[model samples]
Target: MQLVLTVLEIVSPVFILALIGFGWVKAGHEYRIEFVTRLAMTLSIPALIFVALVNAKIEPAALTSLLMAATVGFAAVTAVAFVAVKVFKLEIRTYLAPLIFGNTGNLGLPLAYFAFGDEGLSYAVVVFAVMALWSFTFGVYVTAGGGHPGKVIKEPLVGATLLGGLFLWQGWTLPTFAMNTLDLLGQIAIPVMLITLGVAMARLQVNSMGRAVALSLGKVILCAGIAAVVGQWFDLAPVPFAVLVVQLATPVAVTSYMLAEKYGAQAQEVAGLVVASTFLSVIYLPVLLGLLL
Candidate 1:
């Protein structure tokens, strides 16, 4: 009961309020939401990543585990998504982005922080960086069909990751003032993302709910199961391994909708997946935490 309550306390009100705000103001205004999401994707999120990775103290071995879990989960999901597209004859153009881009930032980061503290958060950051790269490049290609996927290489996150990598390689640290400023900017990224997500959710149609539910379950349950088995084999600690599993279990990212919109995939369908996964995450997250923690 206490665990259940804790989960509810942490997740529900934020989501509920965001839903209400979206319904009240932004449901019909997709453009407005898109503008804000772009700001996050292009600016605040990258800053957050830069600060997190540059400052994070990562063990070489731990980094290997983190990379392993991310790679395995990505491969598993990609294979499943391939099968999904083939079996359903899904318009190859439409389903590819959501099929690949699971919610790593919003749902995954928080759960990782809660479960394994800063170390888990670092791992989640690495996963987010990886997903962002793949989502922008291959995901765009899959969505655009005949267009140039090369444009994805120029995205801000890609540049930021390169810069951050330079810093990591050099063992560089930011000055106090610079670190503080980046942290301040980084803090805003998550809440803005959540509120925007709520706004996006307000626009979802009831008829689309079933498909979204199925997709969300596929991400959380199927992906998480694969992560757990692989993590155990790799001998990851229970907490960190569980953090990876839960991160896999997070909802489809709002970024999916944004990317789908930008690339001309089924944006509304992607949005529905984001909203549905988030709503269901309220239940699934706690259940997962109970079992894993």
Candidate 2:
């Protein structure tokens, strides 16, 4: 019961804010979801990631486990996606993005912080960083099919991660003014992401919902099951392993639709998957955590 409440309290505001955005659109507000997505990708998300990474304490041993988790987690999802595509004879672009893109940043980061505190969050930061890179690069490539994988290489978020890593490696600290600016911008990322997600969900047609649910279930349940078996085999600790599994089990990322839309790769399908997975995550996540934790 306590765990249920905790999960609800943490995730409910995001859903409610999404509903509010949906209402605005229903009321004929001229707000554009694409603009919000672009703003998040180019500005807010990079700022948040840069700030988090710059201040994050790095531990080689812990980072090793996180890297292991990330590598295994990503491979697991990709493999499952591949099998699903073959089995269902699905269109790769329309289905693959949701299967591979988990909500690592907006949802996973805070959940890690809540469950594991500073140390765990630091581990999550590394995993999140890698996942972000993967999402922007290979994930984009998959969504685009053959349209120029090079384009994904040039995304601002990719550049930001590189720059942030260089700064951390050199032990460089941003000036107070710059840090404050980044902090302010970072604060906008989560809310904007949630609202943009809501607006996008509002635009999804009812007909898309069934397909979305089927895809999301495959991504969450199947991928998480894979992670669980791998986690036990590798002997990951209960809390950290559970954190990793929960992170993996999160819905299709909101960014997947953005990338799909940008690349003209089954955008409606991707958007539907994002909405379906996010809504279902509210039920799935707590149950997964309850069993794992």
Candidate 2 residue pairs in backbone clash: none
lDDT of each: 0.72, 0.74
> Candidate 2's error at 131, in angstroms?
3.2
The 10 consecutive residues of candidate 2 with the worst lDDT sum are 58-67
lDDT of 2: 0.74
Report the lDDT tens digits of candidate 2 across residue range 163-217: 7767766678799999999989977877776676677667766345888897788
Candidate that scores best on TM-score: 1
lDDT of 1: 0.72
lDDT of 1 by residue, 149-226 (tens): 576677776677667766876788789999899888877776776676677666655357788788677767777787
